[model samples]
Target: MKKTLLAAAALAFTAGLAHAGDTVRMGTEGKYPPYNFINDKGQVDGFERELGDKLCAMESLTCTWTTNDWDSIIPNLLSGNYDTIMAGMSITDERKKTIDFTQAYYPPAFSAYLGKDAGANIKGVVAAQVGTIQADYVAKSGATLLEFPTMDDTIAAVKNGEADAVFADKDALKPFSKAEGGDFVWAGQEVQLGEGIGVGLRKSDTALKDKLNDGIGKMKADGSLNVLLKKWFGDETPTF
Candidate 1:
């Protein structure tokens, strides 16, 4: 879900290896809701938090969570600030070249345009979170792309008429579209981008990657992943 402009810089930093029984640090953006966000008590709380905790428990690994800005989430992991990225990040070929990913925990989600004008699709000024796949798509679609550091900023741009529309995950935009006294509406045909969301790790952390994959596989086999998806995203969301 990010651009690779800092890939080389990230690659330059090596992960400080962690051994078994050590507390594996999980990094997240703590902004994207349903996936991750800071709760009323100012602690990490959301679907990813619950899922990550369960995964760690099942794997017999001690884990701790930390929050980072979305744009630098991957770089910090490579720099040894965190062992894994549990932010709502999509797995993409462009990203895979920079970091290793466990099997997807969330399936590919559709990107939608949120605005007051229903006819607006890819045209006019479009707002997107900086370095995200939605931003990349808008940049390539010949639309005027306004990049913001956070998802909230993108929505603000649309609300304030700074942009014609905001392109983001449909799930991310759903609340605004249905918000009481708000006029937000879907402005485009939904488009699917990237593979899916997953746990991002440094390429050298193969053991950690394998362990996460194994746990994810069990979750899928037991239908627990589906339960979590529906709990956060509603029954309409797809399952494995």
Candidate 2:
């Protein structure tokens, strides 16, 4: 009963945003757990969701959440499907060519190779989500890179033996690796990647960008950002 109510509330909260004042529609890929995911209540929940909400509150802005497939997240944002992206999107020079980013919310973390064969060659065929930094890195790693539209498919490819291993954000693979028991293990050295995770907005949205930057400054000043970061990602999540 409680779950049902929460689900209803989640739907209503998100669906009613069009009627709210100063609503900022946030775009996210909801499949990445611990970052952003659809919770048991069918609501957007996780680190970014929490942080986005707090940031909106700080800026005195109303906000709503929408989930878009990772592959189309940026395009959809460009199409006005949402106001900004709160997905676990890294700030990158290549990506910056098309979209503007706010100050990084999370430091650039490392990517690792995961596989069933503990002894698999790091140079073997590897899988990564399409268009991600991991995919970009794999292309230059002398490994046969297999790209998938979503993180789930990348992991599925390794489990189904289509790829020798999967490379992605270390933190993203943590829960799955822990839950899979001894099935999957880290197979190679983790490579540091990207500048950090940041909120993506259209390049022309300088007003909104400045507002968000100010809100981020406030969070950092009062230490709420670090508090939420640790609450979701634990003590090791870098804070500055």
Best by lDDT: 1
Off by over 4 Å in 1: 1-14, 179-182
Give Cα-based local distance difference scores for all models: 0.87, 0.85
* Deviating ranges (above 4 Å) for candidate 2: 1-21, 178-182
Highest TM-score: which candidate? Answer: 1
* Model 1 whole-model lDDT (C-alpha atoms): 0.87
Query: What are the models' TM-scores?
Result: 0.91, 0.88
In model 1, pairs of residues that clash are none
lDDT of 1 by residue, 91-112 (tens): 9999999998999999998999
Point out the worst 10-residue segment of candidate 1 by lDDT.
Answer: 11-20
lDDT score, candidate 2, position 3: 100
